[model samples]
Target: MPNPPDYSWSVQAQQPVDYQVSMVQGLLDPSNSSLARACGADGVRKVRCLVVVDDVVDELYGDRFRDYFGAWNIEAAWQPAPGDETAKTLEQAVAITEAMSAMGILRRTEKVIAIGGGVVMDVVGLAASLYRRGIPYVRIPTTLIGQVDAGVGVKTGVNHGHHKNRLGSYCAPTTTLIDTEFLRTVEPRHINNGMAEIIKMALVKDADLFELLEIAMPVVDAGMMADRNPLSIEIIARAIAGMLSELEPNLWESVLERSVDYGHTFSPSLELRADPPLLHGEAVGVDMAICVALAHNRGMLSKEDTDRALRLMCAAGLPVTDAVFTAELVSEALRDAVKHRDGMQRIPLTTGIGSVRFVNDLTDDEIERGLDFVSQWAAEHREETA
Candidate 1:
């Protein structure tokens, strides 16, 4: 029997969707060649293209991307390496840029396409933003984290010393292609990492989404117990669609910008304070619960509402508290959140579902209360299994 047709052909058929969320489509199969065709549709020649990917992704998908570009009669070069911490170094960026320049890739003639997870996107996107001022580029995100958050945003950067994404630019991609097939290789823990974003979207934007999440809470809990449930997929896709609706057209707009940062402020600091950095999603889960508690303190959310939110998160297999989320840690995270905000002004805290205001400042006392609530919830449910 003939081998299955290459993943390329199927991807092209789905390209016309507006994908306002950066023209994303969940291709069922990984189609590197199809991606080449999609890029070429805009009239880019292969030889003029420089494809960049993380070392892992390059090893797994580079040949396929190369073959695809070749099939389209395009001249292409693939840069494969861990482009996260190292890429931010001037030496690394300069070296890569110099090599591409030596290959005769000029500002007007070259298009850099990134195919990998968020880190890959950040590094390559920075390269595209900086090379000869700027160059056109595309994004093919391969991880759940990338598909939902990093892949959609124009912000590109690499870690600078200890700070994450410290050096970067707001360079939007020409197009961003998301193929869910790439997730087959993703670990379950990382998938949970991505779910942090999904849950964050539900809390800040869509009451309906939050309700839907509650309905699927059982399936999510089951996932933690080694049970198989297709509902998890449906919930994930629904959550993704809801977020894309808010982000698609206004990616650069400030309104959605603040909304996206809902739980990130406290989340990052939690990770920083932990001996082992918390997974992005895990920290997000904790932050979301904290926000719900904050809302209650501000009298925007009732105790009942806060309890429900915490319960749902636990049902979704996210921990509301960890040893690292001690009372002292919570106070520090709260203070840091206010300090590190876009403006150092007293920021409003969200008080209920769909109610985010900016004037009610949280005191240190309130922060401790929030931390205690999470700790109590964790102890109560520590032995309970889905």
Candidate 2:
């Protein structure tokens, strides 16, 4: 009788994840039917959708939004929320969830569409993931960062306890619909902020993308990234493709030596600690600059490559250094990263543009040297920035 229940049962299964990133322009134009189709609009049946919109996006496109849905016979319940970094919080996610419930959204039939930057998408995705355990959601990423980076991935998150993305989930949206037209209204600096993520992908996985960025630097400098420009579309599309390629193989991130992590190692702390918190891309730019310095000191990156990398970032209106970024901060951030990456500092360093090498054995002295290099470079380029 005592040994009767000694046998143990084990369950093993593989959960398949499938999602798409659609590059649809004029998504909000009254004549466009892409969004209508995504929201389940058919010729005869009317569609009811609960849309979580950024306050800024709503303010800018509210009328057109109504017109777009009206033309497609979609009854949209507009739920506008703050779409900045501060809105990346658990409370905001809860608010979005509350909005979903009030709409009486059907779990499988109805989909929540998030219209804004990365923050709005994250909040909405998290809410959708938790409502009744799971529900499909759509992302119409307006910001550059959202379209190219955050919106392409399956991760949804909210900031907690003064930490960036401290509480999160890996829940892919039903689909992410990208429309560069929304960027026409985005501030230049905000657009540049998104370029940081694009640049990160270029520096680690695609040299050709880096070249396109360089070629387009002047256009970017002038803040003239019009959707009509094929070059601009190619740039964003390439970055998005490269990011997805890297991510698809390791969607769960079970392998921690991620090339996509090049600039993220220290950015979170600096990002959260800034008095006026840096844009996510700004913080990442600073982090990438540091990694460039680290790579240079390790003799992994050529001086020519280093200069090109930093100069491109500068031309794109990104900060390569922050006063708070120091050797001490580097050490602390790497330590935290080590813990996060399962006891190994899987720090991704650029061997050259479009290539990376992970180093687990980084010493404090090495980190100090990296910081020194950054200090020197920043000082050398001080006049350019001024």
Candidate 3:
């Protein structure tokens, strides 16, 4: 048979990718020209750019957007997408993708500038990834959640049929511009929502950050903004740095045992199941609270440390327990997470404040006990506060 005519062939593909992330003040300060800094002075002027603003953001600052872009001599098309979690759907992504297609966006040049919280970033990022087989995009995350966690990661996705981020891609933005000024306009509850993700980081990776949160929570609760409160700014900077430090090495999640997954293991299901869906970070806080209890039960975390962690969540205005977070829900979440983790429960748990350990073995009884512990803790704390 002539050795099957030697028809088999394979080619190795390797591509090195890098992007810039800038945390700036007054990104839209017309005089500042932050987009130029993100896209490059020359590139900004030359590229065909489209600005996709979150509807909420456009409502708040629409009048200034055109002037801001024109100030830098960058003529760009502006499109607004609804910025709610419900908007993170395939249909919305298709709409944005179609809009970009209509605009004649090129795969290599013309960039899509995503401006809003995590949802807008997710849908727009996914749209940018799909349009023309992947085009460059920039993120200007407007909410606290976006600034700290979502905006920094090389992940983009839309929820699918009651599943959080079931349809997603690892498409890094050309640049991420984080302006703390935007947080000043975010509602207090939303600020607390973002704090949940930061607290997750502190619990698993930085004891110092945890301590900082303990000190800064009171100020944050009292309306701390980066422009007004140095401590608040420091807390935000630490959280962003910590997140980037963890993500830079595992952009593709090549490692299954991830410390950054600390609060994510069981939250996706809970987040989707709630009637009035919990914000992403709120769901994460509940998951982290359960993990804290799990660690305490196993003697990996001291009861004192566990209480401190739970208390911090409360002080930050995050819920550590939810009525809907039942044993069945947890089991379903774990099942879903295991499937995603290649049939292993590489669940991240705290060994100590600022340190983590991964365990593949978790029991139904243990989860029930953890849930009970958190429920009791929540009731007791509520009584004390009352």
Candidate 4:
């Protein structure tokens, strides 16, 4: 009785005239019965689905999805929070696999549905990839990060300790359902956490996205307030649209080592060192900021461009400092990220506004210098906040 949910938005930014992007949109909680009937499934038959979810969503929207699927006589089997912490373990995946085996789920009969944020999506997507050698799945992203980046991208896998995204595959979802309504129930920290990726997409691909985000900051801040702000949702949806538009082709690429990884190398390394793990987007936010600073140090980025990029992150409350960034940890993580890229490969690094390059000529000392500069900035910020 929540008045269902209204879908509306205004387009403030102009769509690209020369560019074309393909996407399929479905309601977050539409009648699945019609879909089943259209597919020639029994009107009373139960379609098997494995839902992977987290605690927050499970408590709030679980019943809604349950009822929605129940309408279609679909059997929704959920693998709720894997008690053992950490996104990189094989234990939870093994458990889910065992559950699927016990259910006697056939490859064609069962479909994996990911119903949470990045962690849940990664786990579910990986399970779908391994189960019966490949079963289709749907993504119901519950977080801004998941909706915009993780939930849409085909790279799915768990972590391997200090290293990030150490295990994964290129298994794109059959479809993704994104409802801005979901963002209403999310915490501010989570929203801020996802902004990192938005900022990344802006920096790496579209300058217009960065500019539009700047214009929408007032609305974003208001959404962070006790009350909801409409514009924030619009901005997030717009950002997702822009990202999807830019990244759709790369969505199914076998090697994501280049196109999708911009500041990720530095960011993931920082995550490993933080006492409390940094959100994926937060790490990327910090890394993007540091990359700007490093680009300036290397004489690749002008001071004006650096300031502009950093200020935009600050306006959105995205982390732009390495206050928690440590030299030793950064070195190790960068090494790991570099290794993840597979040898002295040409890694993408930005030089100017909207300009990026894949250069293998960077020395370790240059990276250390970049980390040092951001470390100093982080220290200054801490003092100011304190």
Q: Per-residue lDDT of 104-165 in model 3, one digit per residue for the tens?
A: 87777678889999999899889887887688999999998998988988899999997999
lDDT (tens digit, per residue) of candidate 4 on 149-219? 77776778876765666777767666666665676687877787777787777777677667777787655
- TM-score attained by model 4: 0.82
lDDT per residue for candidate 1 within 68-171, as digits (tens), equals: 66566677776775744345554555556765676667676456778777777787777777888777777888877788888877788766554556577777
Ranking by lDDT: 2, 3, 4, 1
**What is the Cα-based TM-score of model 2?**
0.97
lDDT of 4 at 253: 41
Give Cα-based local distance difference scores for all models.
0.65, 0.87, 0.86, 0.67
Give the per-residue Cα lDDT of candidate 3 at 92: 96
What is the Cα-based lDDT of residue 234 in candidate 3?
Answer: 78
Q: What lDDT score goes with residue 45 in model 3? A: 49
Candidate whose TM-score is highest: 2
Best by lDDT: 2
TM-score pick, better of 3 and 4: 3
| Candidate 2, position 181, lDDT | 79
| Per-prediction TM-score to the true structure, in the order listed | 0.78, 0.97, 0.96, 0.82
Q: Which residue ranges in model 2 land beyond 4 Å of their true spot? A: 221-223
